[model samples]
Target: MAKYKTLIFILEGSLLNEKVAEQNALRQTLKLTGREYGPTERIQYKSLQEKTKLLGFDERIKLTLQEFFKNDWISAKGAFDNQLQKQDQLNKDVLPFLDEVKNKVNLILLTKEKKDVASYRMQNTELINYFSAVYFKDDFACKFPNKKVLTTILQQQNLTPATCLVIGTNLVDEIQGAENANLDSLWLAPKKVKMPISPRPTLHLNKLSDLLFYLELS
Candidate 1:
């Protein structure tokens, strides 16, 4: 057994680098409805990215086009779900890396991905059996910082927060979330990101498997 009993992973770029579920959802929704209000320029998208209120793909869709496209929301939302089903690329490293600790640790997958979309990704990537639990964006009342989701898991699983680790590819806000929940954090920043970084990670990794080296197995 490893020293830690639980490991919570943020799935976006950590478990899988592809965010096709997000971008594709937006693209597919746009294509289905012929809405061109979506910012095409990188600057515009980047500007919107910083707006926390418009952070969610579904929220962005509903709010931005709510006026003219109000009637077709169900279909537009369906398009988002449809594209998620076809999302390509699973981090090939995920299964092998997870295999190292699955038996000794309570493997939990946490994501901003909604429940259905997350399930679709897990099933399609053959990752359904690897996780003991999965957390969706809609699963919690609020996002990480405002919600101690990790702590919630710790209590539910009868685990200790000090013995848990939250791993993420982008820790800008997630580190704070983990800390607020009283859990340690491990981050993988392959390269420099243009955005300002905050709440430093407890550990940094060059590769996913490197996480195993830090774990104390018994």
Candidate 2:
């Protein structure tokens, strides 16, 4: 029998190369503001990124522009919005991995993105077909790391915490969210990112394809 009755997947970073998209958008934003991306900016951006995890997407962009361009931040924010809307691509291994596990367990896509954005991205990438259900921030009326989001999902799906696994790339959002909900979690750790010592995920893997082996589907 399958170990998990349901697998909750985070849309960004887990299935999509959202970090690449964000980096591309950041570079485009910098270019629009007549600045270049250098080591200093990279370091600063990473620091800011970590600090702004709880903020909404627009707020993060606004803060990023303000940090880089004090006088021209407003215009840069608009540019960043346009740049971000054009970004979003699935990780190369996503389709094959999803195919392998689609029948083994229920696949649920959960994202903090609003319905319009999430639907557009999934439609563009043809990812909606793989998921049995997709839940967005709009549906929950709250962003993740809130235990209620997971609990609600569990209640709606008639699942127990022990029988479901939350898979995500972000520690604060996915892993912590799962922990808060008292559910098992699998972290698809981002490259060069350090794993936290406390509140760690139940399992950690380097890539989406690695899940096949961990899940005994290989």
Q: Which candidate wins on lDDT?
A: 2
For each candidate, what TM-score against the reference? Answer: 0.68, 0.83
In model 2, where do residues sit more than 4 Å from their true spots? Answer: 36-63, 71-75, 190-192, 216-218
lDDT of 1 by residue, 1-218 (tens): 33667788887767765454455655666766666535553355445445532133345546534433467766666676676566756666788887777788788888877877667666667666788887788867777665466767677778777788888755545767886776778876653433235566777675788888778865
> What are the per-residue Cα lDDT tens digits for candidate 2 across 1-218?
33777889998878878778887888988887678899999999899888875454557667877888888888777777677767778888998888888878789989877888777767778688888888988888666688999999998988877778899877777788899999999888665666677568888788878766656443
Candidate 2 has which clashing residue pairs, if any?
none
The worst-scoring run of ten residues by lDDT in candidate 2 lies at 52-61
Which residue segments of model 1 deviate by more than 4 Å?
Answer: 19-85, 191-197
lDDT of each: 0.67, 0.80
Error of 1 at 99 (Å): 1.7
What TM-score should be assigned to candidate 2?
A: 0.83
